[model samples]
Target: MKMFMLKSLCLAAIMLIAVLTGMQLASSGIQKMKGYEDPNLETAVSFHEKDNNVKASILGNDISSHNIAAKKKKLEEISAFNFFSSMGKKLSNGITSASEKLIQFIAD
Candidate 1:
């Protein structure tokens, strides 16, 4: 059924997002900030700015789970966030696909 396929896709998207977020957080040596600094992070469909906590809507369409990282990345190809890549600097963890693009974009 079409509904089943939609549900499966939705679940897959959610899992993918979770895995990405988890990996980003689970890396060693790179102290993870609670959140990255981005003044351009737009108002979220469900956001509140209080007590230094920002809850906002980010990337992804309504049909699927929203990917905040992807949302933060929209039009961010020219940003300064990419220069300080800690990826591959350590022997254990390697670079991520996103970090590669960030490096390339920064180099360009």
Candidate 2:
């Protein structure tokens, strides 16, 4: 019973890792194909121009305006890696180092 439980737990962990990896790969591929850009970095402008006169109100007001503007915003490129995978790596490395240290301490 104990061995069966251990095997089941290990299988679940492996399946979870596989699913996360597949999702990360699919997300990265779609982003690359679509040329995805960060919308949060985008910029916009809103302006209001008005000319008011008392005489114009009684008579008629004629206003002509010409404006030309251009703006460019820099955007950050999306990383192809996911947080879970990166964190998993860091966690595994930490665990490995900790175990090695424990072994060295025990030996000495």
Candidate 3:
């Protein structure tokens, strides 16, 4: 019984160490993005159903590119018209609201 418990504890510790190491490595590498990512399938499908294209494109563009060249390339590649139209209109109207919220949130 003592040996079994020791083995289990050792295995658990090893697994925990591995998991933490992986998390640290991943965290230090490319900073995982935050905020809305529209072109993502989850975002696309959700907004696509509602026909909101602007939000999808802008968000998708933002998600896909961190720089000007990348942005243009991503924009060209992201040709999902259904999702684009659906998100675009919403994005256009919501930009002010979203920006305000962002500003307020950041300030907070």
Candidate 4:
């Protein structure tokens, strides 16, 4: 029990050190890349700024919530077939059938 505890403690300490080292290396690498990146090449507005602008533009337009819901309903109606759900059903059926066959074989 003592040996197991010592090994587990050592493993935890090693993992902690590894994680801290990885974080330090990643941060230093990011800083190094930032120094090489050109200021002129950078975007005037950050990604969050651009995202906010898009959201504001969308809200500013004379689009109603009812219209958006109607559009969504139309799209859903157009693609009535759900490929993933059908695939999942087929996969589960196949697995169940295979397991039953394996159990029958083992019993016999």
TM-score of 4: 0.33
Sorted by TM-score, highest first, which candidate order results? Answer: 2, 4, 3, 1
Residue lDDT tens for model 2, 6-86: 999999999986875676566557667768755442212212345652121101222223211111121223335689999
Error of 1 at 61 (Å): 24
Please list the Cα RMSD from the true structure of every candidate, rounded to 1 decimal place: 19.3, 24.0, 22.8, 13.0
| Model 2 residue pairs with clashes | none
Q: What is the Cα-based lDDT of residue 105 in candidate 1?
A: 100
TM-scores, all models, native as reference: 0.28, 0.34, 0.28, 0.33
Off by over 4 Å in 4: 36-108
- lDDT to native, each model: 0.56, 0.58, 0.60, 0.68
For candidate 1, what is the TM-score? Answer: 0.28
Among these predictions, the greatest TM-score belongs to 2
Worst 10 residues of 3 by lDDT: 40-49
Superposed by TM-score, candidate 2 places the C-alpha of residue 66 at a distance from the truth, in angstroms, of 55
Give the better candidate number (2 or 3) by TM-score: 2
Worst window of 10 by summed lDDT in candidate 2: 66-75
* Count of clashes in candidate 1: 3
Model 3 residue runs over 4 Å out of place are: 31-108
**What residue runs in model 1 are displaced by over 4 Å at the alpha carbon?**
28-108
Winner on TM-score (1 vs 2) = 2
Name the better of 1 and 4 by lDDT. Answer: 4
| Ranking of candidates on lDDT, top first | 4, 3, 2, 1
